[model samples]
Target chain A: MSDPCIICVAITGSVPTKADNPAVPVTVEEQIESVHESFEAGATIAHCHVRDDEGRPTSDPERFARLKEGIEKHCPGMIIQFSTGGRSGAGKARGGMLPLRPDMASLSVGSNNFPTRVYENPPDLVDWLAAEMIRHDVKPEIEAFDLSHIFQAAAMVEDGRLKRPLHVQFVMGVKNAMPVDREVFDFYVRTLRRLMPDATWCGAGIGRHQRTLNEWSIAAGGHTRT
Target chain B: MSDPCIICVAITGSVPTKADNPAVPVTVEEQIESVHESFEAGATIAHCHVRDDEGRPTSDPERFARLKEGIEKHCPGMIIQFSTGGRSGAGKARGGMLPLRPDMASLSVGSNNFPTRVYENPPDLVDWLAAEMIRHDVKPEIEAFDLSHIFQAAAMVEDGRLKRPLHVQFVMGVKNAMPVDREVFDFYVRTLRRLMPDATWCGAGIGRHQRTLNEWSIAAGGHTRT
Candidate 1:
């Protein structure tokens, strides 16, 4: 039988808030409840981001510890993944929670233009984050914002900065970054497979393109994010 | 009859200096002489970057004006393209020479990592540079360090931020950025042709891979840089 499709649900992202969606969970209790709902809906992985007291994104390890504990207790057998995205924190603080050792973390391997600013993942920062993940035995979901990022990730693996059998996420439809295009999406898949045949990959699309990515990912026999 | 291949010579870049190579032109007179040599060798375009008295890269419009004047005087019928790269300056300073109205100006629509740091080209700065190029009637040669930059340039054209009939340069082999790969080179050509059929493109590889890019570009019927 073909490998079952893994549904990864991002319970709360760094960008969205209660204002954007009333159902966005802010507190640890709410986040646990949200993950439990997604768990019941057959999501095998919980992609998480923590919020501060004022509903702002932060790289606070304390809140992340509490959320991880809650998810572990409430959603049995579901993998927990923390976001090391630039929006949540700057520099080393982005990897502060890696010591807690979630099953996985998101890693951006290169810089690209975001909607408003440059989503900077400098070489040093990317090396530092990959080292932290390795030290804590965390698998990184390589976040490829553009095409070169895939090549960079493969280079990191070859150089021993990253490990074998990588998990990569092809992100698309951001305002100034890679937009959602079917041909490019197919090329991304082909390139990743060509570079690292053992790697597993997923597709993520921002805003309205999310459902479109889900359909494409499923049809292409890759994982999907919701 | 097939169109003759256009050879563009980057007379002096930001990183290299007399220390790295004694032949690198640092002064205005030396740069003009260098362009004259390339023009005699059948190069029709002179890609230029100016240096200060201390031999460091600068966005000084005065220096650019002198270089433009020298090239125009020495290499008749040659296209002069100024480098608006991030290494020479930051923010709006990168575009300070656009008003000098060189035949073409290099524009990077996205950001990527250089050897040691993030090559930051934020959105606002990109928009400002594009607008400045439009205001000065200077044609932009899109410097695509990564795949997304091609898409970004096409989007800018569709949105009227840039003029049509684009000239894009596929830059590879930069450390920490896009590396030289034949598969990627072919994809870059195919993607550009798909997105903008009227567009012309060239291949550029840093350091030792420059000759490789020249050969691949020639074989693929694209322009090349030296």
Candidate 2:
């Protein structure tokens, strides 16, 4: 038997131009199908980023509610992972879609080159995001890119903003960001493990990087999902 | 100004099949051109793993001599890095290549899963390799993957078998081995830093893992060449 674990299919992650992938699934009806298909394909988690009707990225509370309700109705036991990532003209990203109070939300510590602009998450933003996740009864999946991010995440856990057995994603393979080399990956894992000995973590790759570290995750006895 | 770093061109390493890439040079002539191209394109290091005359992987002394002569005549001052990774035949790697003792040699510590085989780098072999590198004025680069590898490398350095200002390669994203994710990469860096605070290390990727960590190396500000 395979591992009875949570496999989250991150849908509509990269904000695509219409010229990119047409099947990005922006509306509620389309998101419902996408979640249903992942459920049928044996995923226990549905990681989502909401977009407008015309396919523009949005952090509108109503759209998030519609997407959550649709997914919950279509697939009952699936975990709902809402993104705190806000696109252009969406204002500040921290706690942007937290009002809906999904089962889980994403939180990143430290600033990185997120496409054209930096995904700026100051220390205060992390504390606020963690507090909101606790308030909304949502589990915050800590996203980290470099060494300092791990340190920042630990600070949140220590300050009582996050609970123990933390879940983190060692994101890699982004251009002008951290390199996804084996020794670096080994170091990345060791540093976090040293800092928070018992934290649960996963590995992710930008673009096709998901192709490699996911396997490393499995080898290292960490949970790796598609 | 751009980074004034020495680039290492891996003309051919141990882990490649015909199905992987056809451009993997297998002969002295091909290796010479590969080195020449690398020098012309801003590389100052050539990490070599010699193949037999028939294009199959081999570690014969004659082939090593030919490769050295070719590099000396074609691209002088370009550093040569040889591998202790031997073949399955001839009973635990032929012992002649070590005598040539190039400018550098790779000493991969810890056991890891490579392809279908278990790469067992016993502690005894590590000590022997370290001693060999020290004897010949060849710098020993401790190659590692996963957390255990980091631990082993640190132990080797602590034992005084490996030299100071430790040189290492953060190899990431290889199948059946540790990954090249940001978390893994940074963790490795953190662990190494804690053990040997001033160590200089670089990174590498396998197959299609080209520039991911290379750019990360530049941004993170360490030894970015490997």
Candidate 3:
């Protein structure tokens, strides 16, 4: 009868456009406001991406600094989750955003098609981020779009880069990622459950799939951020 | 890789109205045509519901007789999946569909909510259907809309109505059912893995969730019928 546990809000995601919903923040002030709004709406974690001064998407660490400080100023103690999926093809610049490492940095486990481009998180790049996360003491959140990505991520763990009590996000129902049906969600979850037995995961899906995957998180007892 | 494991085509589902999409068949001829089209479009399984000679949903085994005859005439040897979820309710008439003894009859473990109705598949009805399916050698596709449904069906197994090699369907993102998200999918599969470790399951999602789930099915080595 009480409220469901673990609500995480994904703020300023890299892909969603202003046309999708006008409320998607594109500026430091908008980002700060959005984070606070999500927090007030019952979110404990805020997944973030940076935008240029012109309100365009950017991977610049300084923009992150302002957003981070702004959130701290307004919504203190809120968990900050930074996106490591810098501009699509600028794979080499991933390390550039590590300046304000914050509490968490997302690392896509494998490459897959996105609507406009491929979300390529190559093994070497994944390794680079894992090593860097360890170096900075930042928690790495494995952002998996499909089952193969989970398998690839597990290999990383077996190879010793990813560590215990692993934090994962099973992304579904995206055009270039995994499909967002319940069976697909169930298969991915079951496969991962067998592979990463004790690991903790949450769900993030695009558009309508988000709500569906969100429900899966609620019923499965997985970590879910509103 | 090769074509996906199973191409399940859902035609003439009970709740979706013709107004939702004109493609939804209303007449028996229209419904049969949809099923044949799904089969021709590379689907191996056709999840079906027989419409009245009028547009309303009906549970008459005679109505299904025409459906069966049409499929055999149009696309022979295709798997036919029937619904125990008759449009009205799960009464003796609904439970009575088993006289036809379909190759596969949907066995919803418990009940949940729909937009305007309560789908009640109480334990007594479930027990009756389980026994019938076993005696007739029919496959009971235990369709679960929530986590509790999964357990409710499991209780049948403990009570000896449902035997090994269970076939479950995790129905996702339906209102008053289990929510559609990755965690719920995982929890259902994981729990089922521990309970009916040897069984097979498919995920059926409404609308946009389908494409996303197909990818998960491929990775998990589970069947994916679109």
Candidate 4:
């Protein structure tokens, strides 16, 4: 219990916009300001996703570089974690910003259903992303949307596709994907520990289930993302 | 221990061909002969897949109808189950043969990574296939490639997208999909029972793990597919 809990703040995800919430930071400067505020509030990691001029999600590396620079300047020592999530782009575009070598990047090691479509992380794409992370010395924050993804991450680590001392995030409450079930959440923690004892994991819940995951994860001695 | 087991034989999958094994049946007559042999050897269920003239997998309803008729004549009383698997076709084409209405059709309720690509069974496609199966009076053998698929099937049954008294199949040993693990197999059985108390389930393991799943399933009081 004496160990510090790392608070990761996802300032703006790919889906939400000003229409959804006017407080959602879109521009690089706004994102930097928001992360600075979160950093001041004791958050140490800034999970980032950049948007285009029209405020649509994009994986443009130049925009990411600007965001990274702004964050590093505004919130010193804060972890910069870019999202390689499918929402931002398609195919190799998704990994275009990995070369920026932020402190870390969110990697989805397995595929699952999103609200409307299949969140496809094909095996090759996952391997390629892992390779990119390794080449760039960017630590991966494995996004486990389902039970098997935890196993998939363990396998990748075992096979050297991913490095050890893994950081995994259990995502729940997405429609058509894994729902926020306490029993399943507990199983995720137990399975991750069994698969990779040295691994540090976190839990993320979408929308109304967010508070529940944060509380459960905190109580269970795991990290939480807000 | 005294429950009679259902011996299901997958005569020809979409992957293996005559190049892989000369005994692999491609045409309707070949498939009929193969099923008849398996039927004589006590295979109560014949899991069928059809190939075009060039030996490529297809979801042609005419071919499926011919195969169904041939099996009905040759393997009398044996169950005919067609594969609505992704390898055979894309989208609704995967379920084209359902209208022919064999005894059953395999249905994947979720998406996951295959060795080379994403084995996509999108939410809408799964819903469509399940609806087709229901419309055609074709019982679906729910394919549980990953753990969440079991839950998805349970949810479908709960919502009447799929009828109750479910029959589910747990597929393992795919390259990038679920690996053959005894503990996972045991958990699958336990979870299925917990989710759908009246459900009957089976275990299918690929390649060298096939015998292991068959043995484990029989020893654990579930069905086995070869």
Candidate 5:
């Protein structure tokens, strides 16, 4: 029998706003409700990003705490994964919520270009975020934007910077970065399995490619994020 | 019959100095002499970087002109390719020498991590450099530090931002970046071939892995740099 697929629901990404999609939950209360609904729909993980009063993305630990509390209250047994992505904050601010000790957190192990700019994840910053995750005993879902990021994650695991039995996410369709291609997607899965045989991976796509990635991930025996 | 190998000689890189290696060319005259020697030793392309009076890397067009003149005079029929790499300069200064219009210039289409910092090549800057190269009639040697770069190059070509018949370099063994792995090197070659069948490619490795990359490139029917 095929392994059971883990479904992660990203209720509010840093880039999307209510203007982009009316149903995108911006407030903490709405986020909790959306995640609760997702959990009832069989989603086990909630990949989260918080917004400020004006609906702008921020790395405020207070906002993350409230959201975490709401999720725990409403959706028991659901995993909470905070985003340490560059879009919400700069430098150390991106990892400010690590001390909250969410069940999991997104970690970009290397830098790459986004649609409009270069996503600046310097080596020292990556090291610091990884160290903070270790201190807080939080699992990192390695965000593999490019192929080298997967290799970097493996290197970190080998050096004990990250624990074994890694969990990585293959992100695709970001302009100026990796686009959604079947061959490249297959190569990513093959490379990850070769490097970390016991590791688990998820596939995520930006904009219109989200459903395509979900289907591909399910067919490939990996996880998918909505 | 097999295609003839094109040997490019990078006489002086931005990071290496006389202190790092006593043999590294520092002055323009020393660089010209080094290129002359390499040209005589069957190197057809000269990958050049200029230094200021105190031996610091700079994007000064005047120094580049002098070096270009010296190479043309001393090494007849040699291809002079200037280094527009980030280590030598920042922002538009990195492409300041493109107006000189050497036979070719290096171009990085995406961003990735360097040893201790981010090698930033923002999308706008990449487009500007590509436009300048087209304006000056200079061919670009697309520097692929990671896998997405090759895809970026192909995208640029498809969008008419970059001309076809591209030449790319597969760089490896850089700390905090892509390391020298045989499987990855092969994948890079395969991906490039699948994306742009008419394009030419070369292999480059930093530090001790340079010779290994040379052998790999030559054995794989691609070019190499020393």
Candidate 6:
């Protein structure tokens, strides 16, 4: 009945800006300081996204490298997970930061709807991103926006594209994507365990339900993203 | 227990050609003939897609008009459902034929991964399509490729974007989309019932699983497409 909870902090997602919340970190130095504070406060993992000089999301490998260096210097042993999310970039550019070889990178294996547009993770792009992660020896945190994505990850694992003992995160409460529901969360955990017995999983709830998912995941003996 | 199954025949989908199967209909006359034959064979609904002169898929309104006229004249009382699927056109072009006021039109309320690319049904596009469907009084066969889509349709119904008593089709067995699974199929039915008690549903299996979904739908008191 005991499990160690791994708290992953997504300091700055692709969305949300200073206008939305002034505390949102947008620069590499600010991100490092914010991540160090999170690490000191008990977050073991830093889920990161890079922004350009103008504070727009970008997949610049150099920016990623600088962020990684800053985090490693300030918060030693803290897990750094770069975001390869679609909003930051498109096609191969999304994986451009993989060469920096962070501890982990967020990967979406299937496409689903976002708030206003389609989160386009086509098969070829998915395969390519996975291959890049493997080549760079960077672990992937599978983002399961829908039920099929869990199965897609399993299929990729079985097909030798992804390694076993998978790490998946079930995200909910997006506008056009899966909403926060207790039954769906329970089903997701059950299905993940049934499909990949050795796999580890987590839960992420967007907006106001974030803490709700954190509690649910921790109580269910899974990790959590904050 | 008193459910009467509505059999739908997709005479010519966006994919497949005379080259793949010489019997595959391409021209307007061929499509009408094929649909008429299907109507005679017990199909109540004709799911249609028009092809160009060289056999490529097109969203040409003139061709759709001709096809509609032929189906109406040849098989009275048969339901004509045009495919507003992504392959035939992009953006508003996909809904151009909705003004023809066919009995129904296939509508994808959410996006998912197709075989080679993202089947992008963006929110704006989905909203626009639904608006057009409402304007033309054409019933939408909500294409539920994944579980969340059912919830999306339910939300749309609640918000008045889509009418009540939804018509959803669970599509399975595409390469990157949802695969054919009995557990998933059952879950879809149960979830649909739980979400929208009065709503009706259908099932469609691509390629090899066509008959399997048909059997499942018929056995479960739902409609089916071939």
DockQ leader: 5
- Candidate 1 reaches a DockQ of 0.90
DockQ for all candidate structures vs. native: 0.90, 0.02, 0.02, 0.74, 0.92, 0.85
| Tens-place lDDT digits, model 1, residues A116-200 | 9999998999999999999999999999999999999999999999998999999999988999999889999999999999999
Evaluated on CA atoms against the true complex, candidate 2 attains a DockQ of 0.02
Q: Which ten residues in a row have the lowest lDDT in candidate 6 chain A?
A: A1-10
Tens-place lDDT per residue, model 3, B1-226, is 3434777787777866676777778776887888888888888887778766556677878878778778878988888877777473446676566667667888876544443444555556666778878887778888876555565566678778888778788876554234456765666677778767777888877767787677666666667757
Model 4: per-residue Cα lDDT over B111-204, one tens digit each: 9888899999889999999999999999999998888888889999999999989999999998888888777888889888888989998899
True C-alpha contacts between chains kept, each model in order: 0.86, 0.00, 0.00, 0.67, 0.86, 0.78
TM-score of chain A of each: 0.98, 0.91, 0.91, 0.98, 0.97, 0.98
Model 6, range A1-226, lDDT digits (tens) per residue? 2557899998888888888899999999999999999999999999999999888999999999999999999899999999999999989999998999999999999999999889999899999999999999999999999989988999999999998878899999998999888878888898888889888889999979999999999899999877
In model 5 chain B, the worst 10-residue window by lDDT is B1-10
Best by lDDT: 5
**Docking class of predicted structure 2:** incorrect
TM-score of each model's B chain? 0.98, 0.89, 0.90, 0.98, 0.98, 0.98
lDDT of 1 by residue, B1-226 (tens): 1557889999888988899899999998999999999999999999999999989999999999999998888888999999999989999999999999999999999999999999999999999999999999999999999999999999999999999999999999998899999989998999998999988989999989999999999999889888
Model 5 DockQ vs. reference = 0.92
TM-score of each: 0.98, 0.51, 0.50, 0.97, 0.98, 0.98
lDDT rank, highest first? 5, 1, 6, 4, 3, 2
The superposed Cα distance between candidate 5 and the true structure at residue B113, in angstroms, equals 0.3
> What is candidate 6's lDDT per residue for B125-215, written digit by digit as tens?
9999999999999999999999899989999999999997788999999988888988889989989999999888889999889999999
- What is the TM-score (0 to 1) of candidate 6? 0.98
Candidates' lDDT values, in order? 0.94, 0.70, 0.71, 0.91, 0.94, 0.92
List clashing residue pairs in candidate 1: none
lDDT of 5 by residue, A120-204 (tens): 9999999999999999999999999999999999999999999888899999999999999998999999999999998999999
For A1-226, candidate 2 gives per-residue lDDT tens digits of: 1434456788877477456977767677888898899899998888787777677777777888889999999999889988876352233454767878898888775554333344555445556778888888888888776545666577668878787778888887764345466766776677778879878777878778886978887787666657
